[model samples]
Target: MHTAAAVADFHTYPLISALTHLERLPDQLRVQWADGRVSPFHYQWLRDNCPCPQCVYNVTREQVLEIVDVDEDLVALDAHIEQGLLCVRWHGGHTSRFDPGWLRAHAYDDESRAERLAAKPKSQLWDRAFEWPVFDYAALMEDPAALLQWLLALRDSGLTHVRGVPTEPGSLALIAKRISFIRESNFGVLFNVQSKADADSNAYTAFNLPLHSDLPTRELQPGLQFLHCLVNDADGGESIFVDGFAIANALRDEDPEAFRALCEIAVEFRNKDRHSDYRRLAPIIALDALGEVAEIRMANFLRGPFETSVAQMPLLYRAYRRFIAMTRDERFRLVKRLNPGELWCFDNRRTLHARNAFDPASGARHFQGCYIDRDELLSRILVLQR
Candidate 1:
């Protein structure tokens, strides 16, 4: 009996016994296991994904066989399980060996596809009771484990607070460089968030700012934002934040039609200045290929004129109003006052941030801010895990 013990020295599927039978179809190969599970593989697919030293470089582990080099009408001349590996000989005088364990892992059947889609990374939505993750700046700089934990928190929760940071100018850039290079925008590498009389952007003023994401006009907006508080002896300028993804997911479950409208309708965002005229059109609620919330892009201040058809205007406005109302609701908003030596790092694409109107005469409020790409944070976490 050809059982799992027959190929115990080689990699084998967990729930599947050694290959009990192989049936070669006209254009595919089917394998049956002792557990009664059947997996099908097309001749072309097996040929394309051959795990051999010749077809795949051993050092780089990359495929050397170009798709164009393969014969379009390729067929498996013979296929059988040998030493727990699926050995296939093509009609083109080529043989490929595939580990059954690898084959089971890479199956493209409906069940496998559904399982993969369901296992995607999901955000931990937060409300008023959500406690912001706080990290020690010194530990993050000196300890790798601390840094990894901080990055993971930022990835899963989309926000964190770092206390005991140096209250110096341009300090935010140093902290951002630990993960990756700082992402510079039209606002420069490190921009100051203080009241300026001649400020072109509303963020540089003491006016009451609404909850919004940054740089929605850019085609690829910055993913992460770091704000370092140097001075905050002001009054009524409390920091406001709302998890856009959380509210978006709620909107999806409660008012699916409204969610659909926001996802389908593209709104224009623009930033006009003496130096540049940046513009782009994107949906407020963006989703990944698997229909999960990937990012949220909404900026009331940067929103340009509506360009959709006149008939679709009502649907778009209704959805837009509903979303904006949810974001502004007190239930979803978190109000905090940042103090000196404290810094905030948050997902620019997932969190909507705001600031209340402050009395500039009461005291000065200054913060230096910078941006970093989200991929850098994710990459660092992966490397640390390995």
Candidate 2:
């Protein structure tokens, strides 16, 4: 009953396993769970993570104690389990108590680590045959559960479509706010997609834009891209999309060398106009700490010349071309014509998008686009899930 778990963080980690035993080691505390799993927490880690009023702020639930403030050779004077908690008396007369639920949740033993990693959500790879996750904009706007479903689809599938959105200008912001604030860039908060005589980028022109992620030139590309169709009477201009992660994985299987080349080699992507210039150097395919595909940074129109050793230059080109070719492959592409009152929202980092050339003389075509970072999406998802 006496626990500091609620004061530590926003999560409510119910006790999955009771704290059965605790052993005091020289520099760490070893805890055993009722389920027979063992976890070793370093004394410093426990002290630094202390949830008490003195060690952590009550209002923000953020840690205030610095590990360096304690002696490097600090040890636990005594350790025991009492009242469903792991209590420790420090050698310097300080004390710390950990809730069993929180303690088990933060356990770092090999088995526990593996269990947590295995429990993490995985990306659901999709191909052209995949049916899109469609949602009703009105339902999402009015219902919390509907919003959570849409967010989950965006997180796992990386692509989604919403219908019944208002076709008015700037209406994209209303749906975007359901997640968080729009990420601003040189292109303004909401950019109009239409032909312009003084176009700063290819997206602004009527040319057939190749498949690519948005704003790869920035250090951190926008995570989610929303394009709400307001008018589509023009001929051509069908939207095309490809799962960059799926293609990257296929390349990893069919042509590992090319996949490695894209993952290891860094290249420059640049965007410049009379008003501003933005540039970034990063690998086309990014892997997480576990070596899984994490992101894809690619925009052919914005790419600068390849800069690498002469020997690797050829390899880079081969890899880059192969990646582009894969995006073009019909097996992986999804082509759809968005109508007025419909919208496409997807992970900008993992879903490469493009448009077919349209004749300005044919008719009118207009769309409003905006961006929201991945952090905001995940945050909103967690809060809604809670």
- The TM-scores, one per candidate, come to 0.88, 0.97
Backbone clash pairs for candidate 1 read: none
Worst 10 residues of 2 by lDDT: 1-10
lDDT of 2 at 201: 92
Candidate 1, overall lDDT?
Answer: 0.86
* Residue 77, model 1: Cα distance from true site in angstroms: 2.8
Model 2 / residue 37 / CA error / Å: 1.1
Best by lDDT: 2
Tens digit of per-residue lDDT, candidate 2, span 33-112: 88898899998888888788889888898888888889888788888877777888887688888888888878899998
RMSD in Å for model 1? 4.3
In candidate 1, position 120 carries an lDDT of 59
